[model samples]
Target: MPRIIDSNDKNLIGDKVKALRKAKKMSQQTLSDRLETMAIYVCRGSISRIEDKSRTVTDIELYGISKVLETPIESFFES
Candidate 1:
């Protein structure tokens, strides 16, 4: 089976992703589809996990998200 995250580690970008997705009125499936356009194929369940802080996201995925959401990578780090 594939590994996701260590039980103790949280997806740091989860909250940010959720907030931004909501602000853009995008659903998890929609976001996943958008990522696919950028050559990132994260499934809908994976996106739910990402937004819930239960899964890990790659740097490339972050890049794709930044582009699709039209948000700067820096925003993910903001408080």
Candidate 2:
């Protein structure tokens, strides 16, 4: 069967996430650890996948990412 989403990318904010994370000099494991504090569990491997656009992000995960990155959720969608 074919996939529901045709695009190769799994999420829209992956690139932005990578950019912001690097701008803050934050590592993937650090991001994951921080997210865990908010009760959002995304492992370092998963975060690497997210940054590579190979992982889907839930709403709650996105919220935790924004909080940890200190970025607005809308900014993730911005070009």
Candidate 3:
């Protein structure tokens, strides 16, 4: 199923993903490595773009990030 995400959700999700990545002490390259192993093709540049709210990430990418961060998908939208 497709994840229905609003524009506001993009910034929120980006912030949370960035925060989780930081908490894990992982660089965007490391995160990209994990995603690549999961068959997701997000690059370090893409990660930066997403985290900076400069790009709208796809649900598939979000799923990959959720797995990398060990977080649930809904957590991206949580307050």
Candidate 4:
């Protein structure tokens, strides 16, 4: 089965990512560098866009990010 995530869900997830990164004292550039080492080409602008609810991140990208951030996908949804 295919998983479908809407834009609002993406935004919620993105918000969580941003909050987590901040809590970890990481900047967007630092996160981008980590993603780069994982072969994920995401720029700081993209991260900012995602955090600002201006971009819809793909599931694969989100998975990669979750791993790099040392966080589980469920963490992004835990309110």
lDDT of 4 by residue, 1-79 (tens): 6447543444667788888899889999999999888888889999998888788777877987898889998888799
What is the lDDT for 33 in model 1?
97
Estimate every model's Cα lDDT from 0 to 1: 0.89, 0.96, 0.87, 0.84
In model 3, the runs with Cα more than 4 Å from the true position are: 1-11
| TM-score, one value per model | 0.86, 0.92, 0.84, 0.82
Best model per lDDT: 2
lDDT of 3 at 66: 95
Q: Report the C-alpha lDDT of model 1 over 5-63, residue by residue, as the tens digit.
A: 54655667889999999999999999999999878999999999988888888899989
Error of 1 at 74 (Å): 1.1
Mark the regions of model 1 whose C-alpha exceeds 4 Å error after superposition.
1-7
Write one digit per residue (lDDT tens) for candidate 3, span 17-47: 8899999999999999999999999999989
Deviation in Å, model 1, residue 30 alpha carbon: 0.6
Q: Write the per-residue lDDT of candidate 2 for residues 1-79, one digit (tens) a residue.
A: 9977789999999999999999999999999999999999999999999999999999999999999999999999999
Sorted by TM-score (best first), the order is 2, 1, 3, 4
Model 1 lowest lDDT segment of ten: 2-11
Runs in model 4 with CA error above 4 Å?
1-10
The positional error of residue 39 in candidate 4, measured at the CA in angstroms, is 0.7
Instruction: Give Cα distance to truth, residue 1, candidate 3, Å.
Output: 24
**Which candidate order results from sorting by lDDT in descending order?**
2, 1, 3, 4
